[model samples]
Target: MAKMTHMKKQENQKSHFNHISHKEALVLTKIQQIKHQKSMDYWKQLVIAQQQSGFSVTEYCRQQDIKYNAFYYWLRKIREEALESLPQLPEKSTTNPQVAVLSATTVTAAVQTQSSSLKLFCGPVSLEVNEQTSNEMLMQTLRCIKEVFGIC
Candidate 1:
C-alpha cells in the first residue's frame, strides 16, 4: 500500500501541467505564433528560391547548405498543412460544390490522358496531372478518392 501510494504520487507529479498567469500565457502564445510564422516564412521563401533556381531538390539543398531530408520534410509538412486548410467534402455526400464523385470509367479516361510527370498515388487509386489540370479537378479528384477509399 505504501509503494502504491508513492507510485500514485509520482504519477500525479509527472502529470502536472505548468500553471501560469493568463497574461503570461497569452504572451507566450503570441511569441510561439511569431516564431512559427517566422519559420514558415523562411521555408516558404526557400521553396520559391529553389523553384526559381531551376535546381532539383537535392541540388538546391546542396547549393543552400540545407539538409536534403529536412528540406523535403518541411516541404511535405507545409503542403499537408496547406491542403488541410482547403474545404473538405462532406463525409456522406459528394454534392459539395468543390468535390465530384468519379466513376471508374472517368478514372480510366483520366489515366489514359495522363502522360505528365506529376503523379499522385494513394493505395490502388492514382491521379496524374500537369500544369493544365485545373485546381478544381485536382481538388475534386483527391476528395473523391478520400471519400470513397478513406485515403487522402
Candidate 2:
C-alpha cells in the first residue's frame, strides 16, 4: 500500500504541457505557415530541376541541399494523396471484350518490358553500347574486336 501510494504521488507530479499566451500562439501559427510555404516552394524548385536535368531525386536533393529521406517521404505522401483523390474507372465487363483485350495488351507490353530488362541485367548474355558509335559502325567494331580477341 505504501509503495503504491508513493508511485501514485510520483506519477501525479509528472509535468504536463503548459498553456501558451495568445501572442505566442499567433507567432507559432505564423511560423507554421511560413514553414509550409517554404516547403512547397522547395518542392517546386526541386521538381523543376530534376525534370530539366534528368537527374535522380537523390542526386537532385544532394545538389539542392534537400534531405533525401525527407524528400522521399514527402514524395510518397504526395503519391498516396494523389492516388486516393483520383476517381476510380468503371470496371469492364467480360461481355465487352474490346476493353478487356486492350487492358490485356497493355499488361502484356508492360510485363514484357519488365522481364526483358531483368534478363538484360541479370542473364548470361552481356549487352552494351558505345554512345559515340553509329549502329553500322558498332557492328564493324564488334567484328574487329571478335577477330582480334578470338573468343578467349
Candidate 2 lowest-lDDT run of ten: 117-126
Residue by residue across 12-110, what tens digits does model 1's lDDT show?
Answer: 766653556688779989999999767766776687678668899999999889999988877776666566655665577556557689999999978
Model 2, which residues run further than 4 Å from truth?
1-17, 62-65, 77-152
For each candidate in turn, the TM-score is 0.49, 0.36
Error of 2 at 78 (Å): 4.9
lDDT of each: 0.72, 0.56
lDDT of 2 by residue, 1-152 (tens): 24568777666655321356688779989999899656655554455456567788878888978889987776555445434544455687888576344588899987676555411221212445434336665455444333322221
Worst 10 residues of 1 by lDDT: 143-152
Question: Which residue pairs come into collision in candidate 1?
Answer: none
Query: For residue 28, what is the lDDT in candidate 2?
Result: 80
